[model samples]
Target: MSELKIDERCKSTLKKIILFCTVLFLVSVVGAYILARGNWELIEAQIAQMMEGVMDNLNIETNKNFGLSLFINNLRAVSLMILTGFIPFLFIPIFILVLNGIIIGALPMLTGTNFVSTMVFGILPHGIFELSAIILGASFGVMICLTIVRKIIGKNTVEFKILLKYILKKYVFVIIPLLVIAAIVEAYITPIILMNTIF
Candidate 1:
């Protein structure tokens, strides 16, 4: 019976995570599409400004810096969301999800093609795995924060320290591997594909 209860709870948590991630992703894509449509020139300018920074620093010839930077950035992003899960609320995960969705939606808009086509052609290579990692990381954060919130509300708490340790352990085993593979694909495979097809 206890095992059944635990299974049910895990299933419930998984549902919540999927619901939150989907909602966040969809809403952010719509919002960003509207924003990009309204201010395409502004978006272009902003993208150019950002690209300038990347270009100045990244040596495309070697791709060494690009890979390292991409990996570090992904690691940092995942770590930031995971660590911030300590505070009770969905804000951090929602923010990360929305931000990522916005960026994803907006990037294809800048290319002057339909968003679906652009995303399919441009981002699909690394994006599937990379976005999965990001969503999973954010979902883990949401789960942690929601668990904390439930405990505070009910005052029948799971020991936060123990919960946190479990979260950390699961994250190391689950999310890190995804992020690493994503970083590797983004750094190595994505550029070459983009160069040939999209860029």
Candidate 2:
């Protein structure tokens, strides 16, 4: 193909990708709202069950032990799981995304308008960008795994180290900054929003 044609093709591919991502996000959000609105008690029970499963598997002992170290360990574990479960997750990111969206959405729903608005504004400062990074990271991992599996006969030649490095760069570059932004938002902005609402 000509250079101009290639450039046009690239732009078209980019646009399609963006449109797909947007559609995915909207679908997830809508699914979350529907699921959340339907039987909150069941949703709550499912959340508890999931947490219990994690706790059982991880052997989390106490609240004190559930601090920063635990959080980091969990993060590492999840990133590792992404490598293993990458391909499977691509077809079901909506399931995970909706579950999370519902949980986040539920908190505000229960708290009434004042608190909901407060949380909305509080979360927005970082949540949008942070979530995008997370979604993109996951998407990249899923896409890479899918591509490799489709092209290769056996998984023996999967250059896991290189793939892991690529994923980790996204984690370090995108997710880490997102976490920092979220922490600042939660620690500073949330408290201020709450205080202002109260006062």
- The most accurate candidate by lDDT is 1
Could you tell me the TM-score of candidate 2?
A: 0.59
The 10-residue segment with the lowest total lDDT in model 2: 62-71
lDDT (Cα atoms) of all candidates against the true structure = 0.71, 0.51
TM-score of each: 0.79, 0.59
> Which 10 consecutive residues of model 1 have the lowest summed lDDT?
50-59
RMSD of each predicted structure: 3.3, 6.5
Candidate achieving the largest TM-score: 1
List where candidate 1 sits over 4 angstroms from the true fold: 1-8, 41-61, 111-114, 155-162
- Candidate 1 lDDT over residue span 1-199, tens digit each: 3544554565577568867797778788778888888888778787556546544654455567676667667777777777677777555877877877776677766667667756766677777776777777777677778778888789553455555666677678877787777767878887777677766
Model 2: CA > 4 A from native: 1-22, 41-44, 47-81, 85-94, 112-119, 152-166
